[model samples]
Every structure is written in structure tokens, then in C-alpha cells.
Target: MSGMSSTQPWDVQRLPRADDKVFLITGGNAGIGYFVAEQLSGTGATVVLGSRNPAKAEVAMAAIRSRVSSARVRAVRLDLADLSSLRTAVESMEVDRLDAVVHNAGVALDAPPRRETGDGHELMFGTNHLGHFALTQWLMPLLSTAPAARIVTTGSFAAKSERLDLDDLHSRQGYRPKRAYGRSKLAQMYFGLELDRRLRAVDSTVASVVVHPGGALDSLTPSRPPVHARTTGAWLRMAPAALLVHGKHAGAWPAVRAVLDPSVRGGQLWGPRIFGLRGKPCREPVWSQLTDTSVAARLWDASCDLTGVDLGTIPG
Candidate 1:
């Protein structure tokens, strides 16, 4: 927990020290995940970037080191699209206790010629939701070992209006890039909330918190050369949108707070403060679409079957 007073204002820039803690961020090699890693590493915590590309991961680490002096950071290869390799990846982390894990990485395809993962499931749903689901199950033991652990699922603003069609969860009957992408994120948000309920029911110390980076644009995000670069014209063109939305770094606030904020409770939803689209991080009421327990339970069971992870047996 971070700042507990409901009446007191929270400063998104100021974070509590986490020198002895260990935090893992899936896909921390780029975008919002990269900023999340950079911010946490600045806290003196050991930050492990879960990336699929070793070279890209090292580049991200180097960027962080350049930005933050004495930053404690490293990387572990993690490709959510592959299920068989997850357990091995977790073991490779070589950490006994994990204070927090930010489920921040995902895939979003713009146009469809829909793709499936190595496990033969729709790419977005498989990687965004189920991948994190399996990874969470595998990390339960380490999370349980921490005095107080957090599972920060990076949800999406797109999920606010989408409803799950559990019957055709993979969009086999029909598929649109937009709908599939929305549903995948909605599923992950559901998983995050359901996990909160499960952990509480079991009296576990591990907490699950969901966050969405409002609207973020590549043009708005700052350049960190060799990885991301934006032309001055692009930045200027997007400047008008900046009044409402943010760059990827700003989008990272809510998730960063979820890991370090003492006041943020499990099952809570956080996002940008202005119109749920832009501004500093703030707690928001759970979207009605996200509260359907019946759908959540069904998806939980289906996820267990697909990934072979028993959420019913979540540790601690």
C-alpha cells in the first residue's frame, strides 16, 4: 500500500523507496513498460525486464542505466505468445521472492489477417490475457513469499465498452482486428479483478490491481534513441492531442503507482485523471463490463484448461 488517505492528494511524481524489493515487468523493453521499468529502477529496486528479445532487452537496460545512475536493472526473455517456455523463464529469474510483477506487455494488431500464437490460439487473446494468466499462476509461489506482493495488470481503456462473448472467446465464429483486440484486453481486466477476489477469499498477501494507460501516442512519447525516435514534425503534429492524451511515459503512471503506492488496494482500477483519457493517475470506479462475475468464472475455468494453470490453487 502507498498513500492511504482518501482525502489527501497523491503526487504521481513522488514514489516511496523500494530498495529491498524486486519488481518484474513483462515487455519492459519498450513503450509504457519501458518507462515503468525506468521509474521503478530509479527507486533503487531490482527491476527485471521480461522481454522476448535479448538484444532489445539489453538496449532497454542500457537506456535505463544512462537515464538513472546506479539503477538496479536486468532482463529475462519472456514471450507471452509461447506457453511451454513460461515455467522455464520463471525459474530463470533466479529470485526467491518477488515484490511485484507488472503485466504490462501485450499485442494489438491494426488490421486482420488474424494470427494465432504458438499454442494455436488467437494471437491477441493468447498473448495478452492467457499468457499473463499462466505467468501469474507460475509466479504465485514467489509472490506468496513476499511480505506484501502486487500483480499489476495493464488493462486498456478500450475494454470499458466491450463485453466478453465467452462462447466464442477466440473470435473463431467471427473476427475483426478491433473487436478481438478489445475483447482480449477486457479478458485481462476481468482476470485481474477476479484474481483480487480470489486472493482475498484465500487471505493471501498478494494483491491484484488493474490499470489502463489512457490514450498514448508514439508522437507524444519521448525519443530514447536506438529504440524509439519521433521526428520533430510528428511531435508538433500531435501537440494538439497532448492537451487530452499523453505520451507512453505519462501513461505509465498508474501502473507505477500500483506497485509502489501503499494506498492502492486490490481490485481497484486506476487510470489517467482527466475524463479517463489523460492527466495524472487517479483511482476510478470499476467499469460495469468488468464486474460480471459469471463471465469471469467461466473465463477462469477456460483459461485453466487452455494454459493448464489452476487459478483455484493460487498460492497464499
Candidate 2:
């Protein structure tokens, strides 16, 4: 797989026109997902913002329309924590050919005692990894129909410090919020890379890429429509923007690049240019654990078993 180097400067302003393309972004109502939807819609792509809350989705859609008068965007109810909801959301879509699916929805924080999704798996792992795992499987047909489709899974910087424990995949033994979040991210990256390998083996045109929004802070983000309050604490909100926290708009760049950059290929990981926390989108090194083929294969098997969705049999 080819890698993006920091030496090459990528200009977000140069994104090519996406006139008739269609994209579905999970958790597009706020945070980096909202910015990603805005950026894609600005380029003329039809965007579907998937969120669990209808009200929030509507607010996000309104905001997008207000900003880009010509924006073609809509909202759909999608709960990543529930497999049934994911399937229903896909069935409800009118998409004949999906250009890309941005798996951006996830549980960012860990629960003190560890939580489980409706599917009976750890909340963070289930929502972040298993949910996306099932979603991509269900959307394979739409993706395959497109001339060239991309699957951009959002990972995190925390992945660098955490490794998956196959025996305790669900955190049955013990749990820490930060570690749980890291494990989920590591799984996401592994899945993205492994998916790329599988697609190549089947000679399919679909590309799978992993991207991380650097440290994006709500306090630093410019206020927009819908009048939503900042989620950050007042103390941090008042402090000068940290060098590592590059606000939501800048953070969305890596995912946007993974989606639209013609030069980006399957199996490549993209992140911030400055130490993975801030700066423009660029290629970055993945953790060695995430690159382990054996581990990825094992993860793929476990995901299938847990989600009860199989991508292996999908026609190429």
C-alpha cells in the first residue's frame, strides 16, 4: 500500500467537484461528522447525514442548507449501537450507487463499568467496530455498483497506546474508558486495512481507508446555526486554543481527504501533518499492532461472529 508523506502539502481548497456523487456519513449531526458533511455538500455531493436523533439530524441539515444554499443534503435515523437500526437505515436509503460511506459515528468516551450495546457486546467496541462492520457488509451491494467506492473509517490517536486483547475483547475482565476507546479505534483501523486486502483479493474496485480527526475541540469551533451549546467545560473553553487542538473544521480534513483525494489508495492511513494531533491532513504511520495481518484476520472473524453479518460471501 502507498503512504502519504508530510513533505507533500495537500490543499483542501483543491477538492474536485463531486457533482453527482452520493455519500452517507454516520453521526453527521455534530462534531467532525458535521464539518465533513458540510465540506462534501459544498462540493455538490448529495449527502445523507445519519444520526440516532431525528431532531439533531434536522438541525444539522438546516445548518448545512443555510451555509451552502446549493447544498444537496438530507438526514436519516441510524443508531450504530443497534444492528436492526443499521439494516433499516440502509434499506430506507434510495441510493443506487453509493460513492462512499464514512463510518464516523462512535462512542468516544468509555463507561466506568463498561456498557453493552443492544447486541450484547461492549458499548465502545460494539458501536465503533461491530456496528461499522455490519454496516459496510449491508452496504456492499450499493458500494459495488459504483464505478469506484471508498469506505473511510474514522480512527483515533489513542490507538497508538492500546492493543486488542482477543481473550477479553469485550472487556469482561476489566475496563478503563481511555483503554476501551483506544481498543475500539485499533479495531477500526485493522478492519479498514483488512477490508482493503480482501477487496484486492477479489479484484473489487472498492477502497477502504482509515483516517483520524486530530484533536478537534468544540470550544474552538466557530458557532454555527441551530444554536447548540459547546460541550467543553467553561474553563477549557476560556483558555487559549491549545496548539494540539485544531478545532472541528480542521479536524474533518483527513476524513475528507480519505474520501475525495484521488491519490489516496486502499490500505492507507491519513491523519494530521503535525505529530498526528494537529495540522493539515497527510499520510501517517499506523501502529505496528494494527498492521498485523494475523490479528486483523482474527478481528474480522470475531466481528462477523459477534455482528452475525458476513462480508466474505459478498459477490465481487
- Give Cα distance to truth, residue 46, candidate 2, Å: 0.2
My TM-score estimates for the predictions, one after another, are: 0.97, 0.93
Per-residue lDDT for 60-119 in model 1, tens only?
999999999989999999999999999999999999999999999999999979899989
What lDDT score goes with residue 293 in model 2? 96
Cα lDDT for residue 83, model 2? Answer: 90
Q: What would the per-residue lDDT of candidate 2 be over residues 196-215, giving only the tens digit for each residue?
A: 99998998989999999878
* Candidate-wise lDDT, in order: 0.92, 0.86
Going through the candidates in the order shown, the clash numbers are 5, 0
Displacement of the residue 276 alpha carbon in candidate 1, Å: 0.7
Question: What are the C-alpha RMSDs, in order, of all predicted structures?
Answer: 1.4, 3.2
Q: How many clashing residue pairs are found in candidate 2?
A: 0
- Count: clashes, candidate 1: 5
User: Which residue pairs show collisions in model 1?
Assistant: 1-261, 1-262, 2-261, 2-262, 2-263
